[model samples]
Target: MINLNEVLKTLNDDKQQEFINYLDKKNKRKDAKNIQLVKLLLIDKYSSQEISEKIYGKQNKVALHALRKRLFQSLIDFTANTCIKEENSLDVKLIKYIIAARSFLQKEQIEVGYQILDKAKIIATEYQLFSILNEIYHTKIQYVHQYKTLNLEETICNFKENQQQLIQEDNLNIAYANIRKSLNEYQQKKTIIDIKKLIENTLKTQNISDLSLLSFKSLYQLLQITTISSSQKFDYYNLTSFATETYKIVENHTSKNKQLYYHIEILYLISNIFFRNKKFHQSLKYLQLMNFYMNENKQKYLKDFSSKHDLLLALNYNYIEKQEEAIQLLENSINKKSSNVIQNLDIYLTLIVCYFQHKNLTKAQNLLSKLYHTDKWYLEKAGLVWTIKKNLIDILLQIDSGHINLVESRLKSFKRNYFKHLKDIHQENVIAYLKLVEIYYKNPEKASSKEFYNRVETSFNFIDNKKEDIFMMSFFAWLKAKMTKQDVYLVTLELINS
Candidate 1:
């Protein structure tokens, strides 16, 4: 029952209704209880005993458990079938052709089977479905004697080529997994891992060259790895060139319709990297392209990517001095119920930043208060870094609001909880920033003093503005604003421009 409830939570209201209708149609007996079970689960208001009494007019644990298992299986079948119908139409066609071909061949219908296999081969080859193509080639070789028109040597050569492609795909998958594992370890563990070096070594060890023939999905995964590495270092200049070059490669190698999801993902990655590098125009250009591609295929992935798309668009708008538009975008998104908890948290955090930048301290405080979940819950959902970011932002908000006692307590709690983790991640600058915030809270007059300004300047190792992380700069901008007595947003723009 618990497992079923969890799965049902993933469905939207419409999908839940669709699932209920599917259950209604699947029920063959008038006395079927699966539909009743689903309704009870959806309401989420009944105990097992209550549900059993409601459904069976008595507390029947064994019967209730059996009904729950049946409902779970039914849900799985419905979801799997729906996914196949929506996402894998082409693959399904190819599979049906292959199965039909095999059936005909087994029945000694040689000519019809060869014709069907030829059709399957063309579709498979065009989409670079190497595994399916391998099956097609194997089937051909098994009946090669029956079809003398098929040259045995040519069939063997094609089979071997498909095998090579399969090997490359396998190697890419392994390398991608290793890179993700390394990234996870670096994020979670108290250790230093050079992610960029690890990614480079993994690709090199796998013999994956820049011009290696790869499917659209493989290329997207490669870009994902690069994005992770660049994010760790707050460097996107190099990623800009790499992502564009990879985009060009994807265009040359894969069809847009067949790999639209990956194509859209790659576009978003490029735009985000450009945005990070402060190339607002370039980022918008890629975002436009992403939007255009997303609208194709009947907007198949629009819902899936809308939150991220809107988030990036809002960020770009915010940086380009379109604060009202940015705030509006985030405001519209933040109140909507979304299953994407992480993205929703990001929207909340970004909106809070916007509010803070506008000096709307009360609004920021109210929004921050709405994130009522425990830090541990957020840590599990959004990761430790994000949790720390929220804490730091909350502290800054309290400081700006002149809640001195609250700010002091928060600062102390932050240092106690995160000072060592920041140091472990080599983010001493964050620790420095927090200490300066404490100083500003304790002595507002000293914020503009030359001695304190020198302390601020010496505390952080400033890099090229183009390569600096934007969020880090935003925090730094607040400190600089205090020192220079300028608007923090304007200071932020000046810092980025510098």
Candidate 2:
């Protein structure tokens, strides 16, 4: 997870500086070292020793300790004030309204108290914040006691409605939580058989129905289930149906939805589905739509949304044969900092592949150097696909440069690593592809043989038309092109487009 200071900075640099300045003003202090400490924290490079040296010219751990405590409290106070002023976030405004209502009620300002409560109630209902609505209803009952002029019957009825809403909301929240937990488990070695059963049980147990009404959270959960099922079962039609219905739900309720982040996330999920189905044009279209949402609310989402948008859009560009555009997009985005280590690795590996495919060997080599120097902890955590892809790109670069000895050495290391880390048919298919590359390197004269093509197809017949490994589709196409003596680029394009 991203640190709090970094998340705040990503929200707004100017705002963060203003917050620091506000702290200085409140303290009536000038040139505060703690202010600089706050700045360091925002960049995620804060060190007590560095701060102590900068402040006192020697190690003073005691002073640094006091400063850290003060700075943390100052940040909390600043965030509280800032959130109250941010009208764009309904939750923030709802908090402010609730606070104001309580203060007004204590002061015997009955009209103002009721007015504030009314506003908060509207916001809570609009956002489907049933928990908050329950709080509002309980507060209303107290107000009714103080101002007897209010109708008790109406207040009691509203309270009952809120109680019913709370029950429904609780049920939905629990169902969604369970589904997310199962998805996390599915990311491990667990198969889709158990996951599919879990989904069915959740829907029946929760009384979730396609024909009935649903909340935004429930609808999003449904889409997630459909996405996983579609990928595991290769059922694109069900994915399309669910995704389309989810899109319509978002559109229909856009006005009242406070969780607009879901809209962007759903677009990403839909775009990925299309990409996996090899519908590049449709995938690009949805990505464009996702970009429009990100741009429209850039300040609130730019830092979070930009990285994912660049990655998927670049991938679509790569598949469409717009290599320069793909390379440019990935290169620009890869140099920036991100909180997600796994995502960062994905972007770097994708960029390396794009550079290799674009024939920019020098650029690819530069990225490879960075990967080699990266922390081994990250490399280990990046999982099997990353390790295999990185080594393959290295081998491909060697093949392109005609370094046969280097290629042979790397191939030996690659096979060793693959067998040690991966135990699946996918691993075997990838190693087979690498071996095929080695064969071509050793015997270029056999490339155009029809017999060679037949043998190559038979060698990896188990992996043919297997949608589980979309990452290898282009490589398979390149191998096929080699055997048929066709343009590698054209064959790759045809494979993805097919």
Candidate 3:
């Protein structure tokens, strides 16, 4: 009853979109579970199974049942322009306010969301959705206030208290927990292997409804670990099969409003994976998609783009033989953000690599100069710092005349003075050993020497406790045979023949 027809008659197109959007934004709709089901029911009324399949991938029975039930409960009334639903819930009404807050928050506006969330906490207390209500604050709501203006230590401290409340409420939701863990590991400068395991575990959990997105991510994480290890323990085709299956799940759900940022994040990972594996074509495809989504969504989030994207975009373009585009993007990013050392060091190192690749020695040299001169956040990571320096030295020696002899002599002195730098087990981490191997190999004067193999052996020992491929074993075997004047090539040839 309740004059539902009159309500429908009064509302205009924009108002109708507000009703539709109640299920559009991810965090809001996810929090308002039943109302979201109602919106999906409305979309299902206008679309078919196949149309849904094409858009998302497949219809799920649970989702199908929920949609059908909600549609019947609403009792869709026909009109020339608009349709109306009866019996909206307290959850749906609250969801609308949350939506308003979220829109402001996204526009780098936070005060309005804070006021709206204040209203929500009372409704949340009344409705017993305290856990998710805490989530709204911990995840997005507070970030807007915290980042909207200048840094506020007290505001951040209070936000942390709220975050603690969120996690303590019911041990936190899986997605939120996984995100926290992943972020912590990233901040700690953990290896690809450790991060991959966490990402895989996140993807493996069957709780994820967004299959296409989650599967795409799982494959992306696995691909990263495989890249540095120089081995493929997982099958790409099988992962693609998982993707095809997950695409089926993609059909079950409508595109969430947050997919813009989430999609960019996934595609960035895919682009990196492709670039690393030398799959230039697939790399370009993902990169183009990333550019499309990120360009559209960039202004909505932070203004500065992910520096990794710019660097990787350059690398992708280079791989696809688009040198000009690659160099152009690299220059634009560096020029636009020359002063933003407030960001990660990976961006600086990546920029150095990008400039070097484009044959712009001046730009590359300038970046290297700034890297040391700039007091950027290097995550207090020594290995990362060394990676940047070694890469810069390698590039400088390659391009600058007479720098080669100087670099060689510097390295020779380094090998003697820093033989301790090479010999200390803790100092000789995997990356450190790899840098030494690269230095020895590049020096030409050092590669054939027995001492170089000793360094390589130390490197392998660093990998001893970790999972590794047959390639490492084969490499050491070849090295040992060479050191002992044995027929290493013939022995490896027989291994291949056998």
- TM-scores for all candidates: the values are 0.94, 0.77, 0.43
113-169, model 2: which lDDT tens digit per residue?
Answer: 988999899878777777788888888888787887778898789889777666665
Q: How much lDDT does candidate 2 score?
A: 0.71
lDDT of each: 0.86, 0.71, 0.48
Among all windows of 10 consecutive residues in model 2, the one with the lowest summed lDDT is 184-193
Q: What is the lDDT of residue 175 in candidate 1?
A: 80
**CA lDDT of 278 in candidate 3?**
47
Over 4 Å off, model 2: 1-27, 38-51, 79-84, 100-116, 141-197, 221-238, 254-258, 297-303, 335-343, 373-376, 379-388, 402-452, 459-470, 485-487
lDDT (tens digit, per residue) of candidate 3 on 69-92? 553344343222222232234556
Candidate 1 per-residue lDDT, tens place, 305-393, comes to: 88889999999999999988999999988766567888999999999999999888899999999999987677667767688889999
Would you give me the overall lDDT of model 3? 0.48
- Ten-residue segment with the worst summed lDDT in candidate 3? 228-237
Q: Is candidate 2 or candidate 3 better by TM-score?
A: 2
Report the Cα RMSD per candidate.
2.0, 4.7, 22.1
Candidate 2: C-alpha RMSD to true structure equals 4.7
Q: Candidates sorted by lDDT, descending order?
A: 1, 2, 3
Q: What local lDDT score does residue 84 receive in model 3, on the 0 to 100 scale?
A: 22
Among the numbered candidates, top lDDT falls to 1
